[model samples]
Target: MPTVDAVVRCPIAPTFRVSQLAGMFDLPPEPHTERRFQVELPGLDQPWQVGLIVGPSGSGKTTVAAAAYGRRLRKRLRWRRDRAVVDGFDRRLSTRAITQALVACGLGSPPAWCRPYHTLSTGEQFRADLARGLVSPGKLLVLDEFTSVVDRPAARLACHAVRRALDRQTFAKRLIAVTCHEDVARWLRPDWVLRMPEGTLTRRCLRRPRLRLEIFRCRHDVWPLFAPHHYLTGKLNHAARCYAGLVDGELATFAATLNHFRPDRLRISRLVTLPKFQGVGLGGAMLDGMGSLLSEAGAESITINAGHPAVIGHCNRSAKWEFRRLYKTGRKPSGMYLQHPHWKTSAGRAVATFRWKFS
Candidate 1:
């Protein structure tokens, strides 16, 4: 949710194994999870040299990367950028500290004035941001959501850059990546692989396996703004809860669920929210809160059917869902579920109905 922030301190013990790191972050240990459709990576390795993690959208891969990176932060660190003005703090320091921190992350020399952050390409920004983390003495490079938005070629190039950097380094520079695209694996050739499934982790050692992608449910208030048609299945539907995004009491998002209460679980007939607040983590918060609320009320899991792949992907990325049952919708379910200019379509299109379970 907080795009890999620069924190005050990373709590990694120098003696902890990679599996411990996985457990700390709630990832599946190695040798058990699949990658690249045929590999299983183990997690008991120590001082990991380099590894690539691949999974489908919303598979909690980034969360795993964050945990590993956090564990590697027990050493001194800094951040660097060649020509971009570094703003924000990893809770490390002011502007001056930022420049030095970049070097500590691995930059040899930083430009006097950093260019504006927006003008840079996503790949450059990613490398530059990572430079800050890399400079840390003995720091493990944790790259989260490594290639979600970049073009395929750029992702490959980025992977090459990282590999080159690690290969040339005289000393060990541990590298770990969390990505949804398996395309980059051939070049990365990670020493280990970790896969995150619905509510659990499967660790693999070396060989990647075919991933079974699934979807989950979340509520965003933007449904009225960008997905109104999807919400109204021929009728006005309310009763969804909403939230204010750090904007005291505005209800920036909302979610509605028609439930079939049972002894073991709660089957959701409907789940919807506004589109404006979809990707901003409000939806995740809503789903998490709702899941907890339902669980406390005697529900073992939450289940739903959704036609939107984006919804499923969001739920999957959340690491909160468990069981997923995909199903078809109307006889002639047109792809034209919701058409909006503001939303990005390259991620994927919505299905007729997505079945989800919460436990």
Candidate 2:
């Protein structure tokens, strides 16, 4: 623990009018003077995953971090304006590692990945910058102005996505997020927090609040909201039953299930979670809820086969989901097997089928 006692100050020449105003307001005679910070923040060189340095704007937050961290703090990252966002990651990293970093930082949409960084939405660019910063292997990664460019809800939601990303790491790595917004601290669930001005270090093992989603059958018109996030085509099946999962009255996930050749059988057509809620298994929750809805409506067998890596991982981890089979996407079945409807929707990639039931 480096008990920092740094003095933060800037030169000020109070004019006669300013001095008179200060005296009128009973303010300090020598205004805007230096202040000393004795922060007991520790564990920069130690083992940790995520930490935060947060306070109000102009509370000497950045000044304190610079005094303690120095060159380790990455204030800004330069991106190629002409290239796609996916291409902006460090060139030394493998494709898998790059994609993993993108997923971890909540930039999970492949379409957005292919677009130039400057063309993305503010929230999308924030996640992309975080992904680029985290893809490199290091013991410490310091980010300043964390979540400063987005709205309050988006900032909180992105924090959860970032938490999920850091939690997935099996290797040694850590992040120190510098921000002014305090609301995101709980959502980020940081291991430690260093409050500025006060210079207080509070070690915490905080957890983000549990979010429950209410599922409802929604109109197909709402698919436009989720289509941009999906990797597949934006088109939904004509007869597909659409459903939406909401958190706090906002749509967080969208899913579509189609009736198979047999009335009792069902196949999931599309399951998409908004980028803000990605990497937290809401997509799987949408699937589970849709299965229950169809089950009550006379669906005896609800089968799902998705191509997204996150979707596949979620299905494998869920007790309600069981592996049915795996087959090449380009393969064709002969005779009676050719009648299976699953082959019609997914092609050109390997697909794993799973059966869903309440656990």
Candidate 3:
């Protein structure tokens, strides 16, 4: 292992407001000081993928990243705050790759992708930044203030998703994350962690949290909370029976099952998972659980009209569901088209239908 060193010095003025306040409190009016960060990290000789520098605010995490990785780091991770979410990456990458990166990072909504970065929610923007970084990854990728703006659950989910994405890549790269949140340590599963505040470094043997999902019947009122995350924005069918999946008593996934026109059949009219939780397969798990429950209750089959490519691909790959057919729906010239003008294109959009039959 090779050693890396970083030193930051900020000269303090005795006449500054902070120094005056300290003097009033009988504390020493400290002078200029140098803060040092040194670590024995896996260099060109060793096999290592991820590195973490974590501590509270003003703890020199960003300084350490800057000192260690330098200009290459800044160039690779720079986010265009003024650009639309989908346009914030290398133009050389295929559209599929860009969309895939965005989906993997949990900002999979089509509408959100079209909007500018500033318009998105904090969580969405966080995911969009991750997606942009992953689009054209370098030998070293440095991220500052990782998950600082998002909630704890979102932070963990983003960490897990990012790790998964890195694992799937065929090339060799290193990810250095500077964050204050320690809760994501287990989810990130980095090769090493440097706790800046404690001045301690340790190799991580991480254990991921076991996600316990509970599915039960829910009322129509809960749909409003989840409707915004869905790709198709419209009013949910009121007559449908809704089911919500909860992880640790917080709503994670939702689906609406309704009686089909045929006998002994049901259709999933609406399915959605919260944006932060989307990439972790929670939506598919909820769909399977609901299908199992309906099967036990004497339903012959359950079907779904899935337009999202991710959902369609999952259903096709799953043993529990069989792909029925792929077809295109006629263009709607009503309020739906007025609200979502993107669907006005005459290009035939493909929709995949799937069915799960109880034996």
Best by lDDT: 2
lDDT of 2: 0.80
Better of 1 and 3 by lDDT: 3
For model 3, give the 10-residue run with minimal summed lDDT: 340-349
- lDDT minimum window of 10 residues, candidate 1: 1-10
Deviation of model 2 at 352, angstroms: 2.6
Q: Rank the candidates by TM-score, best first.
A: 2, 3, 1
Q: In terms of TM-score, how similar is model 2 to the real structure?
A: 0.87
Looking at candidate 1, what is the lDDT of residue 9?
31
Off by over 4 Å in 3: 10-32, 74-83, 170-173, 197-199, 328-347, 357-359
Q: Per-residue CA lDDT of candidate 1, range 293-312, in tens?
A: 66676765576554444345
Tens-digit lDDT string for candidate 2 (26-117) = 98776467877777777566666888999998888887778778887886677889999879887787777777777767777889888998
- What candidate 1 gets wrong by more than 4 Å, as runs, is 1-47, 63-114, 170-172, 196-359
lDDT of each candidate versus the true structure: 0.47, 0.80, 0.77
- Predictions: Cα RMSD each: 21.4, 3.5, 5.2
Candidate order, lDDT descending: 2, 3, 1
lDDT of 3 at 251: 94
